[model samples]
Target: MFKKPIQKYTGKIGEVEIGTGEKAVKLGGESVLPFYSFDGNTGNTPKIGMEISDVYPEGWTNTLKELYKDVSNDTVKWAQFVEKKYSPDFICLRLVSADPNGKDSSPEDCAEKVKAVVEAIKTPLLVAGTGNHEKDAKLFEKIAQAAEGHNVLLMSAVEDNYKTVAAAGVLAYNNKVVAESSVDINLAKQINILINQLGIGNENVVDNVGCSAGGYGYEYVISTLDRVKLAALTQNDKTLQIPIISPVSSETWKSKESVEPEEEAPEWGNQEDRGISMEVAAAAGVLASGSNAIILRHPKSVEVMRSFISELLG
Candidate 1:
């Protein structure tokens, strides 16, 4: 008889609950590599958060745009549509309109939009800002205040700028913050520690150690995330023990494999199908490497990944 090798982990990813009432979602707390229930507790299945922007998506391919044509004009309507149509585990509202170089939308405007979305949808919300550090700080403060008591997952608090957003999300609003870092594991750990030092418990923090799509440095992301998970499970590193969030949709769509049209490259097959495949491939990689929650864009990609997750868990 042959013996099966079994491994044990000292640390487990912590669980953090978002939203309130029946539609609430819980992420993380997995004791094994995503769906590996035979070795340890799976805790909860990973959650998929559909990404919807506060502003109409600009520069999105026509295929991506058409998917939300009905509600693209309005942020609240878009959130409601995704929840009603797909019933995603959560909804991520990216406040792109707040970008200083873009719409430069006021904090009050962003706050109002956040409030409207929360009221319009039953799903838990993950609110994110444009990648502008200073602008995000201001945006998060208002978003946190507007979403007070809602327990939305605030998108980020980075190494260069975390105080304002961390305070807004953790201290002021009692919400959670996503501690983001580049592909560097040390930077990822450092940011988490910095956020925790601000009195935000590790339980209230999730890590986003950067995400890359297929054919776009995807392997680097996978390895970095795997390292983080290893440190958490094997070394019992507290700073890296929090659940991870990968915004795969954003990176996937940016890849040439996703955006290049068939006319541009006939060998790529249908652009839409290629894009979906790219997103699915990137998402699968992220999940396998230990992502507790993922933000996805296309509806078809979401459906496919959901089914894939079902099969994996089963």
Candidate 2:
């Protein structure tokens, strides 16, 4: 007798909701691999976030600079502009000014800007700080306090400062935190364990297993994502079962192939097209590999990723 084999899983990525009211977005909750609807469930259709920074966005290519030219000077305006024009699944604000090595902007001031951005839009917001552990810990605490009732998503809580970030973001206030680790599966599982030990449930925790642009040592990123998702779906590892969000824009934009000038890299073709292609390709690669959500920079890249997701969902 020929019987179609249907695979069943004992574990599922927990679903966590960000923001409140009508526009709140949910990620995670897949009991199967990426788009493996035939086997079990592919859970949500994944998510795409438009990335905006607190700074003036200098050194950006002309297309992006012009897109937000009027709003580039103000973070609030930048948030509003993207929301009005594109309406991404969510808006992720990069608190670059808070880097101790950079402008070293005060946490208080950054929180004020965050509050204003929250007030200006109905869509949910994800607040991220400079990658420095010490600096980001302080920045996450302040922003978490400012966006308390809104229940926004904080960029991350690394091993160095998970206590500070998880305490303030999840305990003191009603928000979620990203357990970010370098591209290591063991580290990813360990960090999630440490965070859960803080008394935070899986529903309030997401994982950032790390990622890179497609050709730039990206094999590491893809492999880590695969291991984590497979463990969650097939092996049912609770610690690694949380949703994973990859910041594709942050990794792709800085690559030479995406940003080098036409005069310098004429063989590569148009710069904007080149960048968008890079962003879309990198994003598609991660999504296929098992990322629950992604962060994209250029609006065109966001549009392309969204269309690809739509086509896949259909």
Quote each prediction's TM-score.
0.97, 0.97
lDDT of 2 by residue, 1-314 (tens): 98888888888999999988998989988898888777877887799999898998876777778888898889988999899899998999998888898899999999999999998998889988889999888888898999989989998899999999999999999899999999999999999999999999999998889988876469999998899888888898989889889988888888888889899989999999998988898899889989989999898888888888888877
* Position 91, candidate 1: lDDT: 97
Q: How many clashes (backbone N, Cα, C below 3 Å) per candidate?
A: 0, 0
1-314: candidate 1 lDDT, tens digit per residue: 98878788888888889998998988888777668787889878889999999888977778989999999889989999999999999999998888899889998999999999998888999998889998889889999999998899998888667999999888988988999999879999999888888888888998899999755477788999899998988888988989899998888887888889889899989998988888898899989988988989998999998998999989
The TM-score of candidate 1 is 0.97
Candidate lDDT values, in order: 0.89, 0.89
Q: What is the lDDT of residue 195 in candidate 2?
A: 93
Which ranges of candidate 1 are over 4 A from the true structure?
none
Q: Counting only residues 3 or more apart in sequence or on different chains, how many pairs clash (N, Cα, C under 3 Å) in candidate 1? A: 0
> Residue 151 in model 2: shift from native, Å?
0.8
205, model 2: CA deviation in Å?
0.8
Please give the range of 10 consecutive residues that has the lowest summed lDDT in model 1: 212-221
